[model samples]
Target: MSGSPLSALSWRKSSLSGPRDVCCVEIAFTGAATAVRDSKNPDSDALFFDERVWNRFLLAAKTGEFGPN
Candidate 1:
């Protein structure tokens, strides 16, 4: 699926995000792709990942592959 424009997609931060929205990242899941951008700098470019890679990253995150959950 083609992704909607970045400005048009709904961006959301994690519930675990730091207070005052600082040092946080926001994400938008666009049908076939996932987008990531700094909450402090939404206007900056975002990194895009395909569904497969995104899923793998999520799995690794849940499994503590990167570090303590």
Candidate 2:
């Protein structure tokens, strides 16, 4: 992590993001972690999650488990 390998990643936003939406999350994957960052602030530090945790979160999201919160 000392060399900032994340900065070299090719970050991508969701296809659903529209031209008018200034606030979106971009994601990049490394061998050890998944990185998420604000599309509006690419220079800011990104949040990293373990691959297993990221997959579980995606599954929950797809299932609508985080409703009304």
Global CA lDDT computed for model 2: 0.87
Report lDDT (CA) for all predictions. 0.87, 0.87
lDDT of 1 at 5: 68
Q: How accurate locally is residue 24 in candidate 2, as Cα lDDT from 0 to 100?
A: 87
User: Candidate 2, residue 61: CA error in Å?
Assistant: 0.4
Clash counts for all predictions: 0, 0
Identify the runs in model 1 with alpha carbons over 4 angstroms from their true place.
1-4
- Candidate with top lDDT is 1
TM for every model, in the order presented, reads 0.84, 0.83
Q: What lDDT tens digits, residue by residue, belong to model 1 across residues 1-69?
A: 134367888999999987888789999988889999998888778899999999999999989999974
lDDT of 1: 0.87
